[model samples]
Target chain A: MLELKNITKKYGNRTIINDLTANIKDNEIMCIVGPSGAGKTTLLRCISGLEKIDGGQFILDGKQFDPTTSENNVVGVVFQDFQLFPNLTVMQNITLAPELVLKQDKQTAQRKAQELINQLNLDGKESLYPYQLSGGQKQRVAIVRALAMNPKIICYDEPTSALDPNLRDEVARIIIDLKKTKVTQIVITHDMDFAKKVADNMLQVQPIK
Target chain B: MLNYIFEILPSLLSGVTTTLQIFFLTLIFSIPLGIIAGVGLISKFKPLKAVLEFYVWIMRGSPLLLQLIFVFYGLPMMPGIQIVFPRFDAALFAFILNYTAYFAEIFRGGLQSIPNGQYESARVLRLSYWQTFRKIIVPQVVKIVIPSIGNEVINLVKDSSLVYVIGIGDLLRAGNVASARDVTLLPLVLVAIIYLALTAILTFILRRVEKHFSYWK
Candidate 1:
């Protein structure tokens, strides 16, 4: 289980998330739903170690975990726009971090990438660049890239924002199927319909009044 | 006409050697320095960004000819910092500094053109800063700034003639000598052809480079 205790974030003098608290259980899909500017993305950035939370302590399974340390990638984030490296093919994008940061050999990394590609239904897309892929295909590649790190938690920032209704259903199905793989997920979305379709638990974030 | 061309050819060829030396050396040193400076301009350290911005402003605001004169002649006459550079060294020093500033500004814009998601993505993936820069950022920036850098490179080829002001026996200087001595415009015309030829060749290479980078995007 992951715990967020008194999590606070401020941009300049304005406080965005003030004294927030939440609990996310193992293998659970928790969707944080709110109107725009509710700081859902900011909270995700904090957990992903991209943002430094002003007054928050993360306790993961009874251990004081600091994502900022970057000693270990305990969390992975798939951005909304699917920012895959354009210069690299899909397979290279998926395996780059594993080889460079995790010290995995090229064959070991590519083997793992092939497995993720098959699991995510990204077959035969390995040689394609990000610009060459369709929106849905790019998102799947993004998810596979994140999964390659084998993080304990993976967060999605507005995963369905750019998708059509058909692809939205596909995203929902993918999120539900990922639960079977036993990775905890926190999805940030303003689309309540998507949250309801995929979430095992839901939390609402309100703008600071 | 043919005999006159041959007579000036050897002198002009030596000048071409000098021009090419400065052109090649300037690119070799300045491009790498410019990339670093470009990164520095946008760095989180406000002081560094401010300093580099001021530097680029000063470099761009002035003429390359004046800079060449200053480095070669004016510096040695300055009160305390009377460091004298040989004529060739002074021309090279000034040219490198001038081009480095231009390339830095181009790169700064190129770096800015990248999406915020790219940086965030690298961070979330736990990519080391150096790895992120070399593998992800540099490739995109290079692709984006190629056209702009190509313009500067072509400009550099012609601007190499400015070295003549500092008493460097560059292509322009050699042509001037033969023209005045023989009392004919033929050597000067030959000089113009060589300049055009050099730029044309560089333009062709730049187009090829742009094509090479196009493979991804």
Candidate 2:
């Protein structure tokens, strides 16, 4: 479970996310939907401890999560840009965190990465880079990368925004399939239909500006 | 030319050890110093940035010949600071300092090109700052900065000759010594040939490195 208490973020004189508070329950698929510049993405970033909240507190699984206090690595993220290691293969990208962070053996990390790749239907694409893949393939790889780490929660920031309609639907199905695993998921997206289909709880964010 | 090469091959070979020493030593020190200086440029602290900026600026702005002379010959002239560094040490020191500044800019540009999202994703994975930097930032920066670094290294091979200005007997100096005594330009031309060969070999190696990094793509 996660609790964001009075999270307010300001850029210069303008407020982006003001006095926003929300709670995310364990195993819940929560989608944050809002118009452009509605602080939805910013809110997701704060929860992931990527952005500093000007005046607020974030508690993850009952522990205070402060980026200032060295935010814990209890969460995983799949960026809209994918952020895949362009110089590395899909397998390398997926296996990197586990091998380096968890000190998992190379064989074990490879095994897990392979399993995730298969699960995501990326069996033959392990040797490919982000540039070589279609948008949907890249998103799938990003999701598997987070899944390989086995984090308690995963966050997506407009992951399907860059994909075509068909690919977006495919990505949405993958997100829905992830929900069956009961991991806490927060997807920030503009696709209301996708949110309705995959999310257990809908959190509509209104821009403070 | 073949006869000339055979004639002075022994002397050139004698200078090889010193050339390699300077080459590897400069690389060993300048590379890490360059990365640190690069990170310092992007530091949030203005003072840190300013100080590192000034360092890169001064080292880069001044001529390497001038810095070599200043470090080896000029600094010894000071009153109380009579011995900042030993005479032989100054050649290595000057070369390292000059190359570090150039390499720093290459590193900085590479680091800047990476999207901010990469760091954010690394944080979400619970990677510590140093961990993220080592695993994510450094590798990518190396890939990006390599071409520039390779070029600098090529220049460094020729720059090794600058040690002669401070009285170190590098290849160029060796050629000078040979030419002065023999009254022929062959040794100097041989020096040019030696430099060109070294540079060509270096270019080949760098191309391989670049290809290796690009392999996954």
Chain A fold similarity by TM-score, each prediction: 0.98, 0.94
lDDT to native, each model: 0.93, 0.84
* Every model's TM-score on chain B: 0.97, 0.93
lDDT of 2 by residue, B1-217 (tens): 7887688778876776678789989999999999888888888999999998999899989999999999988887988888677656999999999899998889889999988878877767666788888777888888888889998999899888888887876788788888898788888888888888989999999999999888544
Model 2 misplaced regions, further than 4 Å: A1-5, A21-26, A55-74, A102-109, B1-9, B15-17, B84-87
Candidate 1, residues A1-209: lDDT per residue as tens digits?
A: 99999999999998999999999999999999999989998999888888889997999999988888867778999899989999999999999999999999999999999999999999999998888999999999999999999999999999999887789999999989999879999999999999999999998999998
lDDT digits (tens) for residues B38-114 of candidate 1: 99999999999999999999899999999999998999999988989999999999999999999999999999999
Candidate 2: residue A183 Cα off by (Å)? 1.7
Q: Clashes in candidate 2: how many?
A: 1
Residue B88's lDDT within candidate 2 is 60
Please name the candidate that would achieve the greatest lDDT relative to the true structure: 1
TM-score of 2: 0.88
Off by over 4 Å in 1: none
Pairs that collide in candidate 1 are: none
